[model samples]
Target: MSVPQPDSDEVVEQCENCAVKTPHNVSIKLITESNKEENTAFSREPYRITECSQCGAKTRQRMNDA
Candidate 1:
């Protein structure tokens, strides 16, 4: 398996629980491919998820181009 993108480690926006901008763990996963293989270019985008350090809330964040 390939390693997650470097920037995926960054903390996403503010936390929903405590409303604090804290560092959180991040996980990345590739999206599943659809039957329409020809249109799979954009569908391959990975999900960048973040967990709130203060209250343990999880949120999905958009990834920036590397």
Candidate 2:
């Protein structure tokens, strides 16, 4: 079976593997999680998935609301 690939945009960002700002594929994903307490509503958070084009290293970072 073939795996589905996520849609990403090319952007300039810091890459850990390259140790410098480089071109990377960035995708935004919304994560949903349930609260530990009972009868609580689930929380939705947005995160950015970054993949370095040069070294193929991947990283995830939470997106904060300003």
Candidate 3:
């Protein structure tokens, strides 16, 4: 099953481990490294989020760039 979106800014996705919908603060940050050969401007950072409060399920999300 797909995760549910309750509103903007925060995601109310369902946690399979907890068997409930948990609120998560979502954000996207660019990945960078020192002394690296890869490009700094176009690196993809995983859309990250906190664990579910009820069952402590680790969660991650994907974001789209505008």
Candidate 4:
């Protein structure tokens, strides 16, 4: 469930390993859970996964609906 982001949309985020702001490849994933009950509804949570282009360190961030 990896969502692709265009190069123009790339963001500068601090890398935990590098300890500095750097360009990162960002992807989005939708997490969902459902119950066995017929009428039960499922919830979808979107998260952003960022990987540092330089060090390849990855981080996950939960996204909030605006």
Worst 10 residues of 3 by lDDT: 26-35
Clashing pairs in 2: none
Per-residue error for 3 in candidate 3, Å, reads: 19
TM-score of each: 0.48, 0.63, 0.46, 0.63
lDDT of 3 by residue, 1-66 (tens): 444444556667667776777765556655443345677555655566556544557766555535
**Where does model 3 exceed 4 Å of error?**
1-13, 23-36
lDDT of 2 by residue, 1-66 (tens): 222233346887767777777778888987765556663345767888888777789998889766
Off by over 4 Å in 1: 1-13, 33-44, 62-66
Candidate 4 structure quality by residue, lDDT tens digits, 1-66: 222343676787767888777778898987664455563345667888898877789887779767
Give the CA lDDT, 0 to 100, for residue 33 in model 4.
Answer: 45
TM-score, prediction 1 = 0.48
